[model samples]
Target: MKIFEIVFSPTGGTEKVSGYIADALEGEPVAVDLTDCGLGFRTVAMTKEDVAVIAVPSYGGRVPAVAVERLGMVRGNGARAVLVCAYGNRAYEDTLVELEDAAKGAGFRVIAAVSAIAEHSVVRQFAADRPDAQDAVQLAGFARKIQQKISEGDASEPAIPGNRPYKKAGGTGMVPKATKECTDCGACATACPVGAIDKDDPRRVDKKACISCMRCVAVCPHAARAVNPIMLSAATKMLSKACVDRKECELFI
Candidate 1:
């Protein structure tokens, strides 16, 4: 079966986690790049015979608002779907449920779901190099189980993770402020997945438009970007436990 892999990863951590899930499924996964600035709502029609793996990173325990906005373009046509939410070791609050709703609204039949963890999108200390060898092995086994379920004609929806009323997940509000090192090279603006940074002036960030995916921080050639120090300190204390546990990738079939 054809597997459509939809993702909105700016730091590549989410993409890596999604890759493992797609690899496990044994199909050529086509990426629906929400990173494209020109991206907007569009529909993708799929028949009952096909399947889709919808994956996204947990932005502050929720789906990136920009990603959610863009996902409205997908037309599932009642295609069976597996919702996969990858988080940065902290938690996936409403992200999974939101994705489930989005897929259903797009005409996809919800089947299984997974909540995996990767490195923190902004900060580098948590769960680095994740979706590593161990993660791949786990994901491969999970894929095999999912395949088996499909072959056995099991169509029941699995119990998704987390509570009904999702916990409050606050944003870091860590807008990466540009530093003197910035040459106004415009790379950060160009690489911004949500088009948050203005192309002409890299330092200028549209806070309302910014999803704070940290693409600018990661891609800065001169290490010219940084988040507010106060926010970083606050986030560090809040996420310390999460960083210590080294969360793992999960699978459900």
Candidate 2:
């Protein structure tokens, strides 16, 4: 069956996590970058003969709003899906379950679910250098299990982790402000999935539009953007366990 790896990664962590799973499956992956032009609006049309590994990072215990909006545009046509929610060692909370719902809504039949840990996109200390060697081995094994399940024609939706009511995780709502070094080169604006950054002056981020995925901070050539220091510190402190040096990936069949 044709395999597709659809991902929404701004800081490369989610992409790395998704890649490990895709590699193990030994299926030809169709890569769709959510950050790419018009991807947010265009539909990902697939057929029953295909399999999809849909992966995205958890932004504030939820799917990135832009990704949520964009994923809704896809049409899976009963294609079996393996949903993955990559997080920064912090709790995935509602991410995986919500992702399942979104993928199902997009016409995919949920077959498997995964929650992988990667380096924190916002809090630097957590899951640093993750999806590393240990994670790779585990993910490779996970892939084998999934391959077996698919071969057995087991397409039943598996029990995925997350809260039914979706535990309340407060939104950091940290607006990334551009620093003086910003050249107004417009890279951030162009890269933003929601057009949160102003193209004319990239420094000014429309907080209302920003999803706080930190794409602008990571992609900035000048390292010109930053979130609130106090809030970041508090968050890091609260999520220390999630930041502990845990092996990056785990496999479940």
Candidate 3:
């Protein structure tokens, strides 16, 4: 059976966690990058013998809109799927349940689910240096259990916890701006999934178009992009209590 690693990671955090799980599973999986603006996800098709590892980052306690949209286009064709939700330490809330629904709607048979921690995409301090050594070990253990379940011919659906009407997604109020160090390389413009950054002038950012996924910030080699200091301080203060503690990985099979 073939394995497909389908993921929507604007930054590298979710991708890193997915790599660990896919590697532990038993195949050289084909990668389907959901974050690529150029990809035509509707053309991705699979068979019953195939297994898929679907991963996405939790944005503000919910799945990103772009991810949900792209994932819906994939035709699972009765493929067995393992759902993964990677988030900053604060919470994943309804991400897993929502993902399960999306996968099932796309014709995938839900077999297993996982929730793991990764560094925050927008707020950097939360879950910093995560999917570390400890996370890697736990993720591998989860994969082994999943392998066992499949080997034993288990077809039961995992009971994932979350509310039916998912929490409303908030606005992308914060946008990363270019500093004096910006070289106008156009990398950020090319990499932006939404075309928020102006190609002719990299310094120009369209706030309404930007999802605040931080792809530009992460990809910048110059280390010149950042949000307003006042906004960042307030966000850091708000999330400090919830993110400071260590949150462990969870698995459902």
Candidate 4:
């Protein structure tokens, strides 16, 4: 059976965790980048003999709207799916459940789910250098177990956490702006998953469209993009309690 590693990672954290799990699974998996705005997700088709490791980052305990919209277009065609939600140390409350629902809706049979921790995309200090050695070991174990489940023909839907309605969608409002060092290279614009940055003038960002995923900030060669200092401080304080303690990855079979 073929394996597909489908992921939506803004600042590379989610992608890191997804990579670990995908590597631990059976064969070389085909990659489907949900972050690519140019990708036509609707054209993605999978047969029953395929398995998909669908991974996405948890934005404020919920799935990113852009990811949801793009994932909706994929046709799973009865493929077995393993849902993965990667979040900063805080929490992934509804992400896995929402992803499971989305995969089911897309015609995939949900077999397993995972919640993993990654460095906070905005607050780099929080959960820094995560999916570390410990995380890798745990994720690898989960992958092996999931592979065994698949081999055994276990197609039962796994029980995932979170509510049906889901928490009211929340926003971080931590938009990054270009600093004096900005070279107008347009790298940020090209890398922006939502096309929030204007191509001609990369500095001109559509605040409304920006999810504050920090893709632009992370991709900036000159380190020109950053959120306001005061806002970042306040956000740091707000998340301090939730991020202080190390959170472990959880697997559902």
State every prediction's TM-score relative to the real structure: 0.90, 0.91, 0.97, 0.98
Task: Show where candidate 4 strays beyond 4 Å.
Answer: none
C-alpha lDDT values of all predictions: 0.78, 0.81, 0.90, 0.91
Q: Cα miss at 190, model 4 (Å)?
A: 0.1
Residue-level lDDT of model 3, residues 1-253, one tens digit each, is 7789999988999989988888888765799999898998999999987889999999888988888889999999998999999999999999998999999999999999999999998788788999899999989988998888877878789999888899988887689999999999998999998889999999999999998889999999998889898998999999999998999998898
Q: Cα-based RMSD of the predictions, in order?
A: 2.0, 2.0, 1.1, 0.9
Report residue 214 deviation for candidate 2 (angstroms): 0.3
Task: Give the Å shift of residue 39 in candidate 2.
Answer: 2.0
Better of 1 and 3 by lDDT: 3
TM-score: which candidate is best?
4
| Poorest 10 consecutive residues by lDDT, candidate 1 | 37-46
In angstroms, the error of model 4 at 41 is 1.1
Cα deviation in Å at residue 88, candidate 1? 1.5
Which stretches of candidate 1 lie above 4 Å from their native place?
40-43, 168-172
Per-residue CA lDDT of model 1 for 1-253, tens digit only, reads 6788877888888778777767777555666777776754474556777778888898777777777767777788877888888888887878888888777878888888888877887767777777688877887677778777777878888866665566575654678879989999998998898778888888899987777788899889999999987888888888887678877766655
Candidate 4 has which clashing residue pairs, if any? Answer: none
Deviation (Å) of 244 in candidate 2? 3.1
Of the pair 2 and 4, which is ahead by TM-score?
4
